[model samples]
Target chain A: MKLYDRVRVINDGYEGYGIKKGDEGHILNAEIRYGTFCFYREDPETLADDASASVRIEDLELVEDGGATDEDILEELPRHNPEWGCKVIDGFIYNLKGERLNEYAYDYHHRRIK
Target chain B: MKNLEALYGKVTDYLKYGDGWVRRENISPKDIDVCNGEATDDSDTRTCALCVALNRTVFKNDNKPDYTHPYCKCEQIPTAPPEPTLDFPMRKITDYLFVKKRGLMYSMGYSEEDAKEVYQMIATNAKEQFKQGKYFLNALDNHGQKVNILLAFPGKREKEGHVYWIKTGWTVYPNGKLHQNTPFGGWAK
Candidate 1:
């Protein structure tokens, strides 16, 4: 499924065609102390130049739900991604990994944590 | 009178040589609204005279610090006495009080004299209201040594007439450090 369409589906709280093993996804994480989220793709080589790399999630989950079978290794995906880039969704951007993201451009760009 | 003398001595002792202390006096409800430099109304003049008398006693205390008694006529002004029985309504005013460090009073546009006059008027009113059993008084700190007094009148209908009172003052040590004292009083319903 297209990344945008897949994100739209999961965000709606419905389990559609699920993320497959070895299929690259993005991870999003939140920095609670700073009141900010981070985004980064799992593998840089898999990221398409034109495709978004990251998304932001409400929080990190230790295990992924909605796997087809119990044998499926529930990969804990970050709510944010960096390499695949970001897309604005629902006033927030969701990445291929189903994570939420934000643009890092800030007043003091140099001081931003990578 | 001996008690007054003894109280004066204690206050002066607290003042020390070049030291400063605050002098508080009880004021009547009628005197609360009077303005500065304006002739005090006849009814309240007696109250004002009491304040002046207290000021004189504070001045005569031998224990007071040198270089002009730390008792600047500044704090000699009368304040409303606390009411233990009557209930009065408290009203909040939009204007906030702000005091600057080093014994300076600051208001948006008012000169030093003007600010002092306004402050005196407000303090008087707050004290009177407290006596009438209306509101509460509070204080805010600024730049360490300076403090602003707030008169928070009661808001609840049942608490309508209680007033809170706060008076802020500062003493400067020889090392240039400032010590602050904010005495609080209340007129309970």
Candidate 2:
């Protein structure tokens, strides 16, 4: 599954992560890691959500494709919190309202910073 | 504290220089959630301490790595020392199995009274098995240092007679400490 693709958990082995079979979530990203296809979860929002697990591609089944765009989600953030804003003073750095983020934390396309 | 000293070496070595080792909060890019197909603050869960004057400091040698928060990004600078082989302590093992995941243990046919025996059975074998590289990689947090190793030990549940009870989550720190994040995920198919 690719990023933004909605998918269902086809595996019940993730009970420790509070994820069970039939639960659905959005695919934040996907890539080959440690020689296996894995995806990240972004839905089933909850306050207690703090950890992200490396889900194998086979464990998930696509529910929908190309559901939401970044701008669609960005437009919703300021409505929820007014302090939220992006200031790129330097090389693709996204700083928070109160934090001084100078070093590049991510790429322009959200590719993880190595 | 002694365990940390044993793992990291003497604190006075760094203290003599006066620029002692401080555990800086190491935030991995994986901890930051991506939104809108790009990195955004909308889903970031990290809470920055507003005061900004440096919250706390631990000696480089002391090596008091924070274990309280699962998502804690505390890191020791100038290259974290290597952890000795088999750093999974019994206290951490039992904490994950008994307290953090007690309910799941019950669901897997273990009782409150069986906590000690259950851990004794699992922990002893887990350490030995881990030494022999008998675990599977279930998942990994971003940056890849923090990983989830899947481990299974035999247990007899009430409904499911003999089973390979899977303990699917563990994390590796920059200092090379192995921590159990989740003990009971379910049984292997």
Candidate 3:
């Protein structure tokens, strides 16, 4: 399945791998490792920040086909609030526009990369 | 803790259907975290992955052990018949699928007749044949010819008793050539 295809958790696999049964979301990224496809759920905060729910390919069943227009994907992605600050190349600090080093630390930390 | 107990129960139940079912085994504390049920690999819940893998490979001598935790509540569950299986709302294969499966089987080098027999073999052993990946499986034809089959488990509808939705089929040879229209999904496959 390509990106933006909707997926639903079909079973309670192990610890649910972060997504519970009936949890539905668009697939942001998918990669096959160790003989299985690991899916990342959709959520975007800032550049380099990935917000996603991890699920096994086995536990997920394709829901909607991914024929999303570029506009659709861009809309689904978490947009950068102009006030949040610029994207940081370094891993630690983000949000320089505000007085704090990381006004959105919680959001950045919660980003599910890969 | 309840989930862990449930997981243990599920494993033992599947064990009952195993062939030449040997003695049941328990995972040790060292292999898995006794305190938190955390996998060393940083996965949130690999114990469940182990459970599925065990259900698939338990009959083999190489089946690995899995521990829910050191204080695993399931360690004391009785091992014997009166086996309790988790009730899943299963789905039955519709007759319409037979027509679709025919083409899937022939794509894997099965003669029309051979495809019919292989189709039944796959349907009957659905659980064993189903693997979580890019929707493909390895099976033998009537002549024991190794073949690959592509099956999809669409999330749109849950086929209660049904495992893989065998909508696509293919075949594989000993040399590892996948003879299906779809490409294998993995590193450089």
TM-score leader: 2
What is the Å distance of residue B4 in model 1 from its true position? 43
Residue pairs in clash, model 2: A70-B36
For candidate 3, what is the DockQ? 0.04
State the lDDT of candidate 3 residue by residue for B11-84, as single tens digits.
Answer: 77557544222222234222221211112321343333332222212222112133244433233222222111
lDDT of 1 at B45: 36
- Local distance difference test, each candidate: 0.27, 0.41, 0.32
Please give, for residues B1-189, the per-residue lDDT of candidate 2 as tens digits. 756754344344355433434433434333221111122222253523210111122223333322333344444454332321333334333433444344556665776677677656655655555444444544332322233334554444673665554544444332233444334434445
TM-score of chain B of each: 0.21, 0.40, 0.25
| Native-referenced DockQ of model 2 | 0.04
Model 3 CA lDDT for position B113: 42
Candidate 1 structure quality by residue, lDDT tens digits, B51-141: 3223211221222222223323323322222222211101101111221111212212333434444444555554444334332222111
| Of candidates 2 and 1, the better by lDDT | 2
Clash counts per candidate, in order, are 38, 1, 10
**RMSD (CA, angstroms), candidate 2:** 15.9
- Evaluate every candidate with DockQ and list the scores: 0.01, 0.04, 0.04
Ranking by lDDT: 2, 3, 1
